[model samples]
Target chain A: MEKVILIKYGEIYLKGKNRKFFEKTLENNIKNALNEFNCVVSRIPGRYEVSGFDPKFSSKILSAVGKIAGVFSFSLASVVDSELEQIENISIVETEDLDGTFKVVTNRADKTFLKSSMEISRHIGGLILSKNKSLSVDIHEPEHILNIDVRENKKTYVYVSSNDHKGIGGMPVCSSGHGLILLSGGIDSPVAFFMMNKRGVKLHAIHFHSFPYTSNLAKEKVLDLAKILAPFNGGEIGVYLCNVAKVQEAVHENCNPDYMITILRRAMFKIAERLSKDKNYSMIVTGENLGQVASQTIESMTVVENVVESTPILRPLVAFDKTEIIDIARRIDTFETSIKPFEDCCTVFLPDSPVTKPRLEKVVFEEAKIDLEKIIDEAYAGIERIIIKS
Target chain B: MIYLDNAATTQCLDGVVDVMNNYLKHDYFNASSVYAPAVKVRRDVENARNELLDMVFASNHKLLFVSCATEANNTIFESATLRSGDKIIVSAGEHPSVFECAKQFQNNGVEVCVVDLLPSGEIDEEDFARKMDRRVKLVSVMMVSNETGAVNNIKRICKIAKKVNPRVLVATDGVQAFGKIDVCVDDLGVDFFVMSAHKIHGPKGIGALVYRKDIHISPLLWGGGQENGLRSGTENVAGIMGFFEAAKLSMKNQKSNFEKVQKIRDEFIDEFQNSGVKFSVNGNGSPFILSLSFDGIRGEVLLHALEEHEILVSTGSACSSKHSDNRILSAMGKSQAEVLGNVRISFNAHDAYDVKNIVKIFASTIEKLKG
Candidate 1:
């Protein structure tokens, strides 16, 4: 009484040339799913078989395998060695109660098998109908169908039906290169990180904390955000906190108050770009929504863009409204921590009336007054790195 | 490190940890089991219940354990509205669990009315009184707001609700106020009260709902007849014991703790005032929680700045922090930028040392940013 669970791949079969990749993926998925079942999963030619388990665990293993993503369907089957006399006996036993219209589906992958697929199907169908007087031969609308699959390795699998489940399948996080996220302990950045993770991009978060200007709760909020992002990225997320108060102070003393945000954003970009380059990240992800604030305006954006020479800046939520962003944040569970009233560095040195739109020439004129590189270097020097675990 | 996010969850006291560890290691038993060890666990649970009842001055009320304040709130609202057409009136500043649960009644044809909050984050008492009509079946208000820390006049509101319709039940979400302030359920004359263990230095997954003895409500879960047949699941004996110990500790040192934290809050506020920082306190109510808005700086930026100093505070209630629009602050009519720059600093009785460090760090950061 050798019992085996026969499993079939669903959508993976649709891939023509890349079928092997899909098959391998599905095989791995099934193996992982059946890991707790303590069964040996062996790959046969057209399908896979689960063996060496208690016969009673067959139904449970089949149901579990069917639910894994990349798996199309599965069935509980009986495995028998390739022997003509044994096949005939097993077929007789399997078709004893086939008291209805019947059809036989056979796959003869094993060329060594003397019986052809058509010959096997016809013989099995006739034998099943002869056993029960009420059964009629209906090739199309068969009430019950028997399946006989022969593999190249001289083995035969007989099963009735296959069952299917959904999966959270995409590329694993970090499969794509990493990106540095300007996580601002607010709703948008964490949501942005979540969005990026969904697309398989791993993240490293950088938080700008203005101690003495903002409370430690603000920093904790960023850390909390990092922690929330951790599980999705498969483990710990690296977080770097930079003290921007000194830079902001230098900018306020050396530059115009209205240009404070512009100067600060440029400095942040410089540091992020430098770190991104250092950490081998291809881009930077920010929570900046266009026109959401003075610094987020087109002019301000252009001014800030002028500072970053390397790495493309990815603003995933640039077009999304606050409501839309918040909705996503709520769905991802970051809305709660984002709504906490922790002040970040951007709030610490905010000018009462920041330039929502400023001429490029005027921005350049203002930039000339401050030691831009020095400020960024100073802020970069104060960077405190914390690796967050999932 | 300074921790001013007590409203989100507090650090446990040594006594709470000791009590919880003792229960976890030595008294771990299934209360429903017939063994003597189980019986002892049941007795301890009952003893803790009686102590809590006495502390709240609600010996007559029935206390039921829940996972958290969210579960407690959901159970009450869901049970109360089991009958169709029951009207639920809630404050606009109510916690999401309460507000959302009340809103859900709309699907069952139960009318939900939201009472507005004043600019000070206090409920408009007159407005609430006017809204209390014969159709209202329940009035749910939070005793102290998790975000603004505005203490509502629960006694006054309950009185008004009862005056309009004696059958109108009053439920108070006391997650923020329970341990920090003295909450005498009978003194306030509420029909139901909810509190979370984590908010008062206990474990995360335990909370309680104290229902008036005579209030008729249906059970949410159908299982073994546990929690007086309200919530039916195996008791989290360890969490409950920890909660009791934390509650006891909070009650014992609440006054001195309050005074100590209040001084730090005042000092922090004074620095902002002296620095000519253009800011406004969200609610002019309790000193336990401070919602400060600094003009020019985004709240997130300030949050990161403070993070550099190893200080931990929040922008609002941790639950609602991830959203950009501060519904609590916005309900009080704060401008978009004003709401964006707002930060919440909550203190517990045990946070004096941390509070001083927080104030010093905050002052210096502001000075640096101001330069």
Candidate 2:
């Protein structure tokens, strides 16, 4: 008895003229994914064949391939000679316990074979019926349909309906580029990070923490956020933690409470823009929702935007409501960590009656009171780069 | 430094900020109130709505503002599928909001058919035709491909869909394409068109769904009858104002900005090609999105490497970034290596100068990797 595995390409079939390139790439990817199986993988026309593996590892290999990006669906099929007698014999033996309504669906690629598709189906169908008296053929509605395929390699493969799980078949990562996510240990930011990542954006994270003002728990929450984001980002997060506590504290001490958030936002933008410039980030992604909070007000947003010389800020959750943002955060497993009662630098000096609608002129006036450049420099000085390995 | 990911979200325009500031300071009143401040708020709301109508080129379309695109999408799905056993057909690739909402009908025994996509990421005509039958109560597709930047032939698809099932409502998730592209619901002939303010440089927490007057949809949220009873909640007046301004600006600069970004995209592609790097573009759908697949290096690795140089790109869609699945690239038949190596370099009109620098960085990084 020869054991064979049938592999199917998911999104590769849609590649049209460039199908072969993708197929080859998928083949290589499958081999790499199944490297531990010690199996021989061979491309056989429409499908690839995996043989000579420890039967014990066959399911594992298939499971791994199922997780591979380019693979659509796969199955372990029984490979037999193209001869009708052999196929019939195998079908009879395989369906010995079958007591349900069954039909044979056959695909004959070898035209030279004497039997037609319908005739083969009838013959195979009759053989199964003869083996089990309780089984009846229902052409339109069969309880189980045995699928048989004949290939040009002078081989026929038959399989039962068992293993067909959907693959997350999209374009591979690095097929796009990288995105720098402004990760706050808040619900909205991580959800925003996940949303952008779903579209195939490789992610690097920027975290703002005030060391003395905010606890290490805040940093730990962010690190946990990174770890949660790591699997999707290929197992690591490049975190740039800027301690804006001092600068924020300075703004709180010097500026009016209403202007504190606006000034602090400007400083954040300065740091984000500088980091974006240094990182060549195409855009800065934030978790800000419009009108969700005082700082996210259009007026405050403008003040923050004015500080950044370049780098478009990507606020994926900008238009999302609190409930929607929280829903996604919960879905992405970030809600628990985000709700851990850790106050970030942005929250430490938060005024009780923070201005909902801060005037741009007032913000500018308060901003003028502080040496913005020096504050930015101090914030940059407090920057810490940490690599999180998940 | 240049910011190019405007289609993702835009900075708040100065005028929008001023308007919001004035409203927040002196006229902060709930629109539902009949009192002096409330009357002022109501007038402002009406003014903003009218302004938005003019901005999007939809003066007559019924506009219902929601929290965001996701809520708008959910509203359409929940409302349109009120009839039992109604079928819905959605494009294979839509924003998660639209796609996930369409999947909800499946649980309700409402037949859901996801139309196939062409290699260019457009809706497959044959597949669309095949999926369109009497059972299909509504057909929803996106105005643009968020991942590939592929602008869907909404006008054509809508035409075909209406031809097949005149009763079928046509909805488009215009989140990515609204401001970036010329979005006139009347011109596109879509029964429902959704737009998110944040995508167009407006504030977040505000989006609108424009429903054709003839089409009726149920309200997803039940609250104070705001947004013509289609959406009920405290209106996000500031966000809406910002959205209107952003929409207006995007409309005003659409052509020039598109051309500018096209030039940058061309330069980046040309430079990458000239550098002799083992790279391939994932989708030939739209110039707004450029997905490049590099050999050997994983996207995360290159992402961090480029981060070291202050270059930010994306691996795929930002939504699925945290998940190990690269559905778009994988759907494009990208291998693990290729999928892992994929990065998206999206640009807006303001991104003209960034491309040149990006080209240089891309060349140097590829060279470094090769060395």
Candidate 3:
């Protein structure tokens, strides 16, 4: 018997006519995740099987595959010829360390193998019980279930389905179209990136930094967040950094101080839209939650997105509460890096009280006070693209 | 580029780098091994230790090399045999390494007395004397205020503590004072002294804790019994050699370097005064570091503005820059505006930058930021 890993999918089965396309994308994603490991991932009839890897690297391989989206469940099992004695021997070995009530489950894909599914299970269960002398059969809520898959490839695979080996159930990355994330070195944007990545959106990021007002460390912190999210996006992410210090300086000098964040955000969306068009991204993703901050209010968001007329602005985290967003951030391992205290562009010329509900006409009037279009063009012209490789 | 953040760290001298490279590339022998080359390396380490001890006039004390000043300071607290009822004293202006340790001990039910800081950034000697008692087991303070470069009278503090309780251990973190000033641990009367290499022109990751020979402190790490079983790990042979070279050069030119730094400091201050900016010197102590407080401008914004001209400065101690509140400045009773506007510009003894340009950039940046 040869040791192998079995991968299962969830949402792709419902794709109907687009199943082939999604399956191909998932296979490529799995390959990318496990690119460092020497192994072969082969697509069988209903699942994918990974073989020819060193036994010492089994756990490492399993962990890398577990992070890929669309993988419903996966298991490390041993494959043998479609024969009863071989299956029974492996099942007995699989239950050698068990001491509680157990059950044997058999899936007979090759009906011509002669023994019925129940017959094979009964034979395997009796043999495991006879050798171990410590197990009893419990079909309902068994402590351990020894799963047997007799496939149409004339091979039977045996593995114990562990509840711990669960996958992150979502569509595979790159299944959806590309978008640009307005990533800030804050708690929300990286989490927004993660949410969209889980929904199969291939996302690049644009960060606005006000150096000499903000610091280089803030830019680095946002880049670090992008690096942390790279693994979920096939092991690399491209981030663009635009210095909005002049834009901020102009607003701080000319406009009312309270509209600093409002006007600054409008500048950011304009730059993001320009870069997205230049790079062929169809949407602009943000982590702007409703009423989380002054600039994130429904009215404030309305004023911010009014500048981006060409592409759709997606706020995946618009309805999530702060605590719920933090929960996902912690789960995705971006919470710790996200909370690093560095001043972002928004905090550069922050006023004492920002306008929670901004009128679109007043914001446009403020925008007219400064040469915003020229400043934004200059900011976009100085964009620094950093590729964080996996 | 002009580097005025010497109090945070200094660039290593070319000669020190050569010595370190020799040890790292050729004489890479484990000091604990029983081979002839290893014996030679151990002998070299001992010689360097003696030389460093002589530099501080601490031949009567035993020195234990550690990772850095932070580790040495932490080791001092970790080796203290204090219990619930025992009392320790630390200054409010102490570095976070010493101040935080005292706070943690207080959390574990130790009686911690924090002496206040005078407006000149010096430790309040009267308050320190008042806090001294027979119940105090340890007295910890820093030799210099890293925030304002105020040199404390460690000899007097040590005498006061010992007179109150002869058994009390006196430790001083001399990271900012060792090579910058004339450091004589013996004359200072400190029972335990901490020093780092990088503050001078030595390599990072090497510091030494010198203690009186008769006093015995327990080990924080137990491994291969290196450093007299106190700090048990492979000896940092290259770093130790580099530290010895840096200390040697620093002492050789200490008197002349002091005069040079004082001259530059006077020029910089004179130029700032002539530039017509209304500013106050936070603490009037050591000429090596100057802390200036502008009334309405933020120190952080000013620091970044100066960077536009390739001049590096710090708003506070590098360790406390990320923290909005400056504990040292606050302990000196400065107001919130003064604390927020304070900037620290330090000078190395071997500095070779033009002082006029720095002040010009400083004044212009402040003017622009104010506007």
Candidate 4:
């Protein structure tokens, strides 16, 4: 019997007019993912099916499918014609090894088929029971449920399980737009990268590595995190490490102690915005959880956000609680590397009490104490680009 | 590439690849099978084991060939039976395999204590004496430091440790010292020893744990009853053949290669010293390994800077380089600043590694970095 992989996506069904565009992009992505292998990815109405490859590489192909962004769930199924006899034969052959109670689920997209969905399910289920006399049926809670998805074009998919992998369950990356994501070696930033990536923005990640004060291990930790996030990117995710030590040093030396984090954040935004405009990025993404710390407060965030108004800064985790963000971090395999106690540039020369509520006008007045342009220019000059490919 | 990072791992010798291919392609047979061809492969594996034993003058020791040095280290710990009050003293600067394995014992129930290292990165004799007690069942130390290359006085340590308690078993990690220097398990008086093939000039994924015949050990991985029921897994036959070849070559060429590598290492050191760069040699270590530290420059940054000029070196121990900090350097009482600026440059006996060219690269790289 011939086997094929059935891919099901959830959100593109709601795209309406742009639905065709999303489907085309998904097809192109699946092709690129399986480029090394000899397989063909085709679209049938609302779903995509992968076929014509060696069955031995099914697990390998499924792993590649899971790395894709728009995937909801994928399944390996036996493909046959819409004829009832053919479906029954294949179902019996597939489920001959399985024991205990069982049921058959049928999704008949082709209305012109001779039998109704109920009739197909009962027919396939009865054939399976005939092959294995010891088995019975359970509708609500069966030990096994064989799913049969029938399309309008005389093609039918039969599998033991419908849901093979629950994907990242977001829009495909690079569909939204391009963004300059300011990544840090922390618990929240990598999660933010995934969150923004889920929303379909191709990320140009920038990490501010503070050497001498902070070690290269800190930068290595960020690179490791980015490697985990790279599988979801439509293209390779290359990170730029900018030495922002001079800017942070200037903030600590000249700015008021209460305004230390506040000013450092403003300087970072200025550099990120400059690079964003320089690189033609449409947005910014940060792992800033609202009110998680003094600098993340509504008033403090405003003072920092006010500086980089040219580009839209996307803080995906702003409304999320610490525990909620951590839940995602652990799921994505970034928690252990993120928690390594290597200090980044932000941790150096920290203030005793950073300003939780500072006016933009006063922040501007404090910023006049140092030359932002000169320090930012120096930091920008030292930007080292490292490409991380999955 | 001016690859001076031989201590990290070595490229296989010229004919070692062909030797490995011969076994892998033609003589592929499961040694456990009772067939004629299988018996021949088993004989070849046993011959390799015998050759390895003879190299270290360990004819009385029973050798169990494993996949990696880490696996060998873990197998020794698995072999030892301990009670709740039993103690194990491991050197603070042992590799992650031995260090973490000892910690696992501590977690289970054994009283594990860490003996300190001197500033030169050798296991401190006084600290070892202090940690020795009737409850201590095992004392583990490395024959040579992988990071700093400080050759430990294993003979003196075994003598001192035996005086305190004759029953305490001594195992030495011989991965770094085996091929680089002269090694004899009997002369060193170590009960158990671990060594890997790639550390010399053989293929990777091949290491052996040679223990005395009277000392009992169990298998960490239980599979087919191979390696005399001590380690039960399919023998890595091709790698063992490569290892046997590399062991023979290394033993035959140890003295000549030692003189040549030491001379090259000294020349490179003199070049750095003459260039007026603010650098400090970390430890009086093995002549083949040199650990240098610049006053204010980060070792990682310097390593990358040198890599731009095609010189490959290392910053700290590669195994735990991604870990937050250097536990070994800190344990040796090196200050935070010195530890941060450390880089290890190791040499091997290869025709491509010219002493004059490597010395010149070191001088130019240091000059560019300093300027």
Candidate 5:
């Protein structure tokens, strides 16, 4: 009566020579997710089976499996010996209370078995029909499909995959590269972190906080967002909180009022670029969308991003609409935390009329009134680094 | 730390903890259970109830011990059976517990009217008298404004409302006025008086709703017939005993504590005047609390600035600090800047901190933030 979890992966089977690399990353990621539980993940030829866990933790393990990238689907299954009688009994137990149309699916990897795959399915189908008079066989589109996976390990796993057990199908995290994500306590940035993480880019976060102008609750809100996005990034996200109040104050006092957002964004990007270089992250990620605000326009993006000379700026939601980004935010459970209305650094000294399109030289001239290097260095020296785990 | 946010909550007095432990450890019996110890516990709870009622000089009223002031306020409205087209009046400067309840009543087809507040944060008695009518079933006004410490003349208010419509029931939220000033519910002529324990150095999670005996109030919670069928569930024995101890101490030293707190408030104002920082007093009423406004500085920023030096204060009432807009300040005819720049510095009778050190911190922090 041992129960296990059966995990199936997609897209990785299409990977060419680096298939093992993806599989290993996915295996390590899943292991990290279920590290708190007492279980073992064993490879079973084109699938992975998690066993030796307490029965009470079966649902928890399946939930963790459901959050993992590169997984197509998973099931809570009962493991039995390869004998037909044992398989028949477990299949009956699986469909004991279930009624309606069902089809028995069998994959016989054990060649020594007497019956073929179709023969096993037909035999189990007839036996199940006789036992439950409420059920009939529907091979085309069955309400329930009882999958009996007979592996080469001399064990057969009988499991049922409910409609809610589908996995988040994407590339395995950390398989692509590492990124430094500019996370803000807003609706867009956390969703951007999720998008980059789904594409196999592991992320560390950086948030700019204005303390006296904003409160401690604003910083806590950003930390909560990081905690929510950590599970997709292998259960941990390193966040660096920079107090940019001094820089913002300098900009507010010295820079042109119309170019306030542009100069402030330039300063943030400069700090982000420096941090990414020091931390050895490959790229910088943001939740910037096209024409969303005055700071997200084509000219604004050009002027703001020009400060980073070496790193590539990745805007995953550049072409997305506001509603589309919000949908992803709601799905990832960061929408509630993001909409907390706590003021962040961006809202501290918002200009009444910020320039949407500015000349590069004028922007540079306005940014030079304040000692950008000195202020950014002072802000950078006071980084409060925290590691948030889900 | 110089904790000046006493109006939000005060630290539990030392003796209150011991009193609470006595009930929690030794006399831990369910008051409803049929046993000797349970009977003793029930009698102790009743004795505590009687002692609390006596503290307010409310011999003609009965007190129901509930969870907190918020629940007590809600129960006042819940106990009253008001139909559609019936009217209620609440002061514009009420606490959210009362203000939100008024809004809920208005949404449910009752005609809810709001009385105005003067710039001094006192209730406009003329406006209150004008709003009084036979259709108005209930009138809720706080004895002390939580944001500014402005004491409304509840005795005068009750007299005027009763003259207009003697059938009207009047409830006064006395959370800030309970221990800070002399409170005689009989003298005030209020049908319902709500008070909390935590604001007066007592234990939290316990409050009382003292109502006149002649009035009929239905139970909000229906259960095992506790609180004589007014409120349900087992009595909070430890909380009751702790509250009684705190209330006893506060009542015994009311006169001396009031003089000390008044002197401390005067010292704060005199020292600020000498510092030449240019600040305005928001309102004048109770000596236990003081609200100040600076011309260009944000109160929250000043609060954080002082917080770095281990001085804790509040921008407004702690419950409404999370909200950026100040409804009470706005209703008092203050400009948006004045509302945003207002900070409340409240005093506890038991505070032993030096006024000079706190004023020095305030001056230095304001200087730094002004840059």
Candidate 6:
């Protein structure tokens, strides 16, 4: 018997008029995700079924489909003829091992099928009860749910469950717009990247790595975290590595030691804003959660946010707590890579105690100590572009 | 670049590399196949194992080459057939592989006890005597301390342990001792001993566990029958060959190289003292390893300072540097400031020729850093 996965998505169904466009993007993404497995992906109303791939790779396809943002869940299913007897037999086999009270949900997409959804559920439930004496029927709350999807094209997919893959359900990538994330190698930033991508923002990231201060291992760690989020974008993560040594040197030489992080973050925003303008990105996203760290406080974020003149700043994690960010990071599989202990550019010269309530006026005054234009121009000359393959 | 982190790992020798490259280029057959070509590869694997055995002079004990010293340590520690509440003792300064595994056994209801080390960084016999009881099932101590390079009296420890509890099985991690010093499993009377090839100028991923032939060990990795069913995986043919060649070379040059490196190590300490720096050595550790600490400068900062001059060094054990504080060094009673300033300068035979020149750069780097 041939086997396949029947995938269903949530939220996209509520788009109404633009549902077609969202479905098209999602289907293309699912196909791209499983392109290496040689599967035939066919779309129907409210669902898509993957077939022609080897049954051995069903679990592989299931995991791949689970990563895309539009995915609600997927199931390993067997394709059978639409006869009620065929459906009855498959349903019996699917729920034979399940115990306690159970429920059978039958969705009839085929109008010409001989039985109503109620009749089909009753017949299949009777067959299952007779075969397994250990089970009782419970429509309200059941220990196991055997789902039956009866489609129009003389095909029925019978499975014991539905939508097992709980993904970041929002919208499809590239469906909303394009933006850039200041991808720092930390737990919060990668989760922010995943959250923004879930909102349909196609993203390219940029990082500043200082060689003498930060090791190459630190850079490798950032690229690794990006790769974990690459599948959701349907390709590799695009990153631009900028060397800001001259900027850092200028700050250390001229700026106050306590203002190191404050000035350093300002320099990053200045560079990011210029790059955003050149790339035509509509906005900038950061992993800043309110009061989570010294730089993430209201006073600090406002100062950093003010450096970028016009591009809107999005802090997806602003309302989230550290555990919530970590939870999302763990769900996206980027948590482990993010926790790797390597020095990022900002961490190399971390102050003993940074200003928690950093006044913008005072920060602006500290900025006057360094030659801003010369540092920016010299640092911009050292920008390096690195393409991270999935 | 000048690499001084030999205690962490070493560059694979050209001879080992040539052997590995030859295996990669032409010999691609699985050793388990019944074909003649495959049988020849199996012979090569056995030849490698025998060569390793010869280097350790443990013909009576069974030697199985596994993957790295960590695996070898785990295999030996798990071989002990101890029930819940049984006592097992390990030195406080054991490598993470042995120390961590022993601690985990406590979760499974085994009574895990740690014996402290002497101020000189040697295993404290008084503490061991106090810890070891009649119910102790196993005892593990490294042959040489990886952090301090202190030569552990494994022979004496095992002798004392067996005298106290005749049924106690003793195992030692021989990673730091295998190439730098002479190792004979039979002479040591240790039931189990482990060594890694990388520490001895071989590959990074291959190591061996030599144990008494009568003991039975549980296999962690199970698949098609391999390594006499103790470890079941495709024989890492290239890695095994690399390990074999590296072991052979180390055995041939162990004595002369040890003496030559020892001279340079002494000179390094002498020159540093002559530079008039307020510093002190950690302990009378191994001659190959020189652990020195400056007064106020952090080891990591000094490590980078030397790196600026194209030199590489490590601060304490490289494995534990990032994850946590050096528990072994801390347990030896080194203060916080001392621990932070502790830098390890381990020597290699190849680097011994330029010892004076490297020491000169090191002294200047310190002055530049402190000036």
The prediction achieving the highest TM-score against the true structure is: 6
User: What is the TM-score of each predicted model, taking all chains together?
Assistant: 0.48, 0.48, 0.54, 0.56, 0.54, 0.56
- Cα lDDT of candidate 1 equals 0.78
lDDT of 2 by residue, A316-340 (tens): 8888889988876765557866887
Q: How accurate is candidate 3 locally (lDDT)?
A: 0.87
The reply for model 2, stretches above 4 Å from the true place, is A1-390, B1-7, B82-84, B333-337, B367-371
Model 5 ranges with Cα > 4 A deviation: A110-112, B1-371
Candidate 1 local lDDT, residue A73: 53
Residue runs of model 1 more than 4 Å from their true location after superposition: A1-390, B82-84, B354-360, B363-371
- Which candidate number maximizes lDDT? 5
Residue lDDT tens for model 3, B65-156: 99898888888887778899999999998998898888888999999999999999999999999999999999998988888988899999
lDDT of each: 0.78, 0.74, 0.87, 0.82, 0.88, 0.82
**True-structure RMSD for candidate 5:** 25.5
Q: Which is better, 4 or 5, measured by TM-score?
A: 4
TM-score, prediction 6: 0.56
Query: DockQ of candidates 1 onward, in order?
Result: 0.01, 0.01, 0.01, 0.02, 0.01, 0.01
- Candidate 5: the clashing residue pairs are none
User: Model 4, A1-390: lDDT tens per residue?
Assistant: 688888998787789888888888888878887876699899997789999986545655776788788888888889998787888888887787666788988898998998889999998888787789867999989988899899976899888963356777778777888898889989999899888877777898999866767775577668778877787776478798888778677777887867877887887888889889989999988999888988888998899999886799889999998999999987766886698777888888778777788999888988899998898888888888889866
DockQ of 3: 0.01
Off by over 4 Å in 6: B1-19, B22-371
Q: Distance from true position, residue B62, model 5, in Å? A: 39
